[model samples]
Target: MSDQQENKVVISLDDLLAQAQLLKKQIDDLSAARAELLDSVASIEAAKASIQELKTQQEMLVSSDKKGYLMFKINNQPPQKVLVYLGLSYYVEVDMDTALKILDERENELKEASTGLDKKLAESKAAYDQIVDILNQIQAQAQQKGE
Candidate 1:
């Protein structure tokens, strides 16, 4: 090839390499974000399960006198009042109705947040796929030029 043609090939390869590196970084960032979202979803689901258990216990308490092991074994205790978290290492004792209301509100908030995260994950995946397609095209072009 002429010097000019060779220069063009070298420049194109360099450009493609730079683009690949940037896309790889973006993919890594997106993967990390997705992982975080998954973790949050898992945590919220676990919290929801705990709230459901508490709600069940509250119902049982209202019906009749019964004792159950706290934290599965800390101590057998009667469910008289519920301790509700008030954020930042604070908790307030509240009646069953009030505590259930708070839990319901928290559940709704978590559901909304989960929905938003799902949308963000979908968008990130789409962007990642497009970048991958572009990278593949670049690789094919490079291979063709090399032949």
Candidate 2:
């Protein structure tokens, strides 16, 4: 009894190979999907970082435009120059906002992909467990017949 408990149950090579082929294929597909999910996550993170940097730049441009407005009042600078600079700030802000939206969408897509991969992995594991159980049953029956 102790020997059986101490030693892990194992299947013969022929049975293991025959049953495991399908499970192995499923595992391989799940692994590939997981890798793609990770890649998507990395891309989303990088996009988020890029959006943050763009946000910082946009804020800086807005402050610069405000400074230009004050200088226009004090230095009597040309109105056209202030208007053009303000327009640049608006464009930068709008572009940064769009980038942030895309980053969020990508993050959501990654989340969905990860969930799908997790489900596939669980199903593959269940199938493998079933195969193992069958192998164990066959081995036990053989031992009993021998006795």
Candidate 3:
């Protein structure tokens, strides 16, 4: 055998396929995580906009599936406080400014998490591509040997 052929590192086809499967799973999981993070960010933005709107609006429409929609009149007075969710089913009542700040912080955290997941997803996809390339090369080599 030539030196070039002797220096080749042989990897099992089955093992490569298994690794590709695992990488595909990882990519899917990362994509789901990133999607959740983005959803959280959007929720935060909506909350921030509602808070800002409440400062200027005196009347609002509230709705529930069981009660339908109700128009509430605030006597031309803005709300003094609002409840902010702090994860794990915990909520705190605070002034509008404080609530906005908390939401901003939470949005930032979610954005950071999404960004991290994006990086991991990219890496997993690259690994999956490399595995597929290796499998294709193996298939081509087997065909050549058979010929």
Candidate 4:
């Protein structure tokens, strides 16, 4: 090939490699974000399970109590009311029914958010795979040229 043509080929290959590297970095960042989201989703599910357990316990206590007293402790004292977390370090004192309702709503929201994040993670992975395939093809072409 002519000297100018050869130079153009080399520059094109360099550009492709640079683009691939940038894409790889972006995919890594997305994967990290997705991992964090997965952790958050797991935590939310655990909280939901805990709330459900508490609700069940409260029901049992109310059913079995004959003297209008339930056996439970909070802060080393008898519990007064259920504390429902409202995010941002805020909490509200609520009855068992209200607490259960709030927990159900929060669980739904977490499920939706988890689904969205999963979709995004899948798309990012597919893009990363495509870039890797292109890079491999470029490397093979370069090897053939060298031969």
Candidate 5:
């Protein structure tokens, strides 16, 4: 092939700047999404910790004769609660067992969901960073052209 035909055409500065702006916006969007996921991860972590704490509390109750209960706080509002187990022979209480089972299932679901979201968020953030580097290189070349 001829030298002219073999070489790729160069992009204009104006076009480069425009593309940089678009890339910057994409980076910003990815950053925002990552922030939101971080919030979600925090929430999940808090929930996981709370669940573990509740389990500990439940175990404490099992060891004691008095029944134990759980308190829930939502939207910074009034607390809600549910009884965990009753006195004597902890296995005797079917209701408490069901409640524990449900909580366990829910915790597992939340953990899985958070993991998936975090993975996607990480991938998107990396992509955003790569685009930013490309934008910077293009802009740098464009600047060199004027000199």
Candidate 6:
């Protein structure tokens, strides 16, 4: 009866280890998602700032390429309308005020998503820690039994 019980404990521990691996993966994925969302919010903030600056300035230097090896003036004429990306390769044309409002909404949504991911990450970490504590306890018991 003792041997049967030991076998069951070992099997249960193995199952727990598998679950820990899955939780670790989920934690990593959630962290990545949160980071991506934060990056999007930063990008939106930059866009909003650029638009505001353009409204006050006549022209600003801009790079035509990614490396910025070459540059030219944007020649902002206080754009009455601007194009805003709506995600998934979609965009919409709206007035300056409307574009700013839309960007604000997008930023808020991304921040909320990041917040939700943070909550899930915390829960996953707690569960993983609990599993690790259980495994450690079982290991300690096994060592004492062997001794």
The sequence of per-residue lDDT tens digits that candidate 5 reaches over residues 8-46 is 677676775676576567656755765665665564454
Ranking by lDDT: 6, 3, 4, 2, 1, 5
Worst 10 residues of 5 by lDDT: 59-68
lDDT of 3: 0.86
Worst window of 10 by summed lDDT in candidate 1: 59-68
Off by over 4 Å in 4: 1-22, 55-80
- For model 2, residues 6-91, the per-residue Cα lDDT tens digits are 89877676968687788978888898889888886785686566456544443322222523563222223212211111223552
Return the top candidate by lDDT.
6
Give candidate 2 misplaced runs (Cα > 4 Å): 1-19, 57-94
lDDT of 1 by residue, 42-135 (tens): 6546545655666555332222222333323323343557787766899889776677677667656656766775676577567657756867
lDDT of each prediction vs. the true structure?
Answer: 0.62, 0.65, 0.86, 0.67, 0.55, 0.89
User: Would you list the clashing residue pairs of candidate 6?
Assistant: none
Instruction: Write the residue-wise lDDT of candidate 6 on 1-147 in tens digits.
Output: 899877774457679999999999999999899889988898899889978987889997767775789998787587789899998999999988899999999999999888899999999999999999988999999999999
> What is candidate 5's local distance difference test score?
0.55
lDDT at 111, model 1: 65
TM-scores for all candidates: the values are: 0.57, 0.56, 0.83, 0.62, 0.44, 0.83
Model 2, residue 111: C-alpha shift (Å): 1.5
How many steric overlaps are in each model, in order? 0, 0, 0, 0, 0, 0
Is candidate 2 or 5 superior in lDDT?
A: 2
Cα RMSD (angstroms) for every candidate in the order listed: 8.3, 13.9, 3.6, 9.0, 11.1, 4.5
Looking at model 5, the pairs that clash are none
TM-score of 5: 0.44
**Lowest-scoring 10 consecutive residues by lDDT in candidate 6?**
5-14
